[model samples]
Target: MAEENRYTFTVRQATEADWPGVIDALTSAFEHDPVMNNVMGGDGKSQKVRDLFGFQIRHTYGPKGTIDVAVTEEGKILGAALWISPEGQKGGLIDEIRALPEYAKVLGAGLLRAAIVDLKLLAARPKFPHWLLYTIGVHEDARGHSIGSHLLDFRRFQLGELPAYLEASTYRSAKLYAQHGFVELFRFKSGKPVLGMLHPAPVTQVSKNNPAGR
Candidate 1:
């Protein structure tokens, strides 16, 4: 049993060398998540899931995006968060097509087809110039230690006035986002409901504090 007070970890930008560990953590964390299982079309630990996440990490970890990891003092990766800046929101049909070969290889043609359709449906939502919280996962053993909240808080602090966005695939996740100040924008119904949400920019709070518009 990992106790929150007894455990301590640091959250930092993940490096390429951290990819394997990050993937492993995410796989373990989301293995039973409804949306992840639906998207990857398998038990989340399948090679398909790993390949899908690897593809996303590769594309989302440069100047336009980042992967942040929470690691123990001894450098054990315990959780990860994937975020994409406004400039990285170029995930249109072309990007989906480009990802097809890899997904097809891992997931097979049928699952790949269905997954692409789901992706397209999700992508149909209106987008704004806001930071996107693509995914966050904490190791099962580390669940009660507030690693997820800490990662979210770290991003919120760094983002300051910028807005953030995500789609919550389960009501439980929606509640988690709500606790973090995200408001539901809309819900899309596939086999299950997905709540799209936005954490509006902190500009109002900034103005409230400064009053002089500084």
Candidate 2:
């Protein structure tokens, strides 16, 4: 017999009311992420980390991207995923200018480095249209569960023909992404190494009704 599953949760698109939970989960999730620390120092729980998540979640990705959350039956948020839909892939220059003040607040003197990191990632990304997984994080308390996998699959299946792309910050994450059909395109060094991968659009038809393939 297969091992019994202990945790139960569902992944869904995040809404305005879920921003706090989303930020908390992501802050905890990326608390120690190498790429995250490289861009914004301090483990993942600092005010800068919180502020960085707040700015990205509410102002940047939230408006022009898709945000997904994993929640238990009682409605406690376990993890969150931030994404930039292909439609909004190339973020507007206006958006970047508008984001300067907020980025300054979170990054301070390091804002220039953070901007450089963003430019580097942008320049490294594939030229074709694809969904960008900006970041996905799980609350520390919920680490052992398969919440991250669920969050990734939720959007991956619903994406129709669009491929998905993300920079895997660690070897473990890169392997995990590979398990889900993501293949590394290249690796680049910033503060930490980043492995850029792509999950090409599936060859078979992905049902509209059964989006998650459940």
Candidate 3:
């Protein structure tokens, strides 16, 4: 089972023009994700799921935070990662209210349920100045090629000394993150369990001489 990993794809900041590719990769990747299917009321191919991802990417994330996509030299996108700056966290009730219409579009009758699940996940996040690894996914066709790892590597480099927080949608995804230095904080269960993980700042190593590791 083997060949070289594709260094062919280079990660770069995404643009509005990249929406089609980004959405394709995201939807394909999460096609079988139970939590997402439950939220969108169908599989990733459903219009509801596509609409929600589009809303977040094109409207909120692109304008407010950062979205990075991995593209090959020939211009094919293999994956995308969305991040929220510490100052851009939308953990406020006002922000949630603002997104009501959009969430309602995809969630429809399940809006409240989706909101509750989102609140549960949000509440599990650490309250600190850190980047939020909002969402990341690799196209189904590109899985096993290490695209996910490359994306995470770029984020780690971009992060510098700042920590990163994320709620891993599945244990499998959590393991992938663990390889990149994230440790599980807690597992929140609201039907499907999500693992909350954090990649502590490199500064956590400053405890070399200190007895208790901060």
Candidate 4:
């Protein structure tokens, strides 16, 4: 008989000490993106995938922010999500997005503000506070285990019903986002489609039948 594969992992809010692992996973996940290169603009190099993830970790998750992780029982870092909430803020969470260099270069001040208005309009309904899921990734060695979906669910529990948003870098990931209840709100015309998606709550269904392993 074939040996059975048994592995178990869980998701939780990432601590400051988890930043390095998160960065490594993110770098490994996005190291070969032609569209990201174009988005960088100057000579198509903005920051190393690792460095960019590191900077976002430092800038956004510093004092009081949100970053969630999925880790194996044996302590392997599988996936992560870095995000922010605008519950007590005067406006939408897109303000935090505008502070990121990637969004700044692509979206002008007027467009940014206009987007914020749209965000506010959608999230102003009762029981909704906006969140920005800046980045999420699953490590190559741990891809098939539904780790990404678990990480997203963990983030939702951490943030408690806050509407979440993210920019999907690939159609594969966009489909993954959709599987997790993220609906595309916009798409950027570029080397590859960059999809912006939103979800009123985290997705609960996770498929363990797919072939997305590394």
lDDT of 3 by residue, 1-214 (tens): 1222654777888888888899888888877787887676666445666677888876668888898899877777889999988878765557778889977876789798788777787777787789999889998888988888888888788786689998888889989999999998887755365788899886554654564855
Candidate structures ordered by lDDT, highest first: 2, 3, 1, 4
Q: List the residue pairs that clash in candidate 2.
A: 31-44
List ranges where model 2 is wrong by over 4 Å.
1-6, 203-214
Summarize candidate 2's per-residue lDDT along 1-214 as a digit string, tens digits.
Answer: 1111655788999888889889888777777888777777556446788888888777777878889999877777889999998788665556777789978977898788788887888788888888889888889988877788888888888877788899888888888889888998987855265689999876445555577889
Name the lDDT value of residue 195 in candidate 1. Answer: 84
Q: Is candidate 2 or candidate 4 better by lDDT?
A: 2
Per-residue C-alpha lDDT of model 4 across residues 1-214, encoded as one tens digit per residue: 1111355766777777878888878767666654444434323232455655676577656444677787667666677877767743434356456665664544334344435433543443334457877677787776677777777766666545457777777888899889877898776644143677888654322323333532
Question: Alpha carbon lDDT of residue 135, candidate 2?
Answer: 82
Cα RMSD, each candidate: 3.3, 4.8, 3.6, 9.3
* Weakest 10 consecutive residues of candidate 2 by summed lDDT: 1-10
- How close is every model to the real structure, measured as TM-score? 0.85, 0.88, 0.88, 0.66
User: What TM-score should be assigned to candidate 3?
Assistant: 0.88
* Of candidates 3 and 1, the better by TM-score: 3
What is the Cα-based lDDT of residue 175 in candidate 3? 92
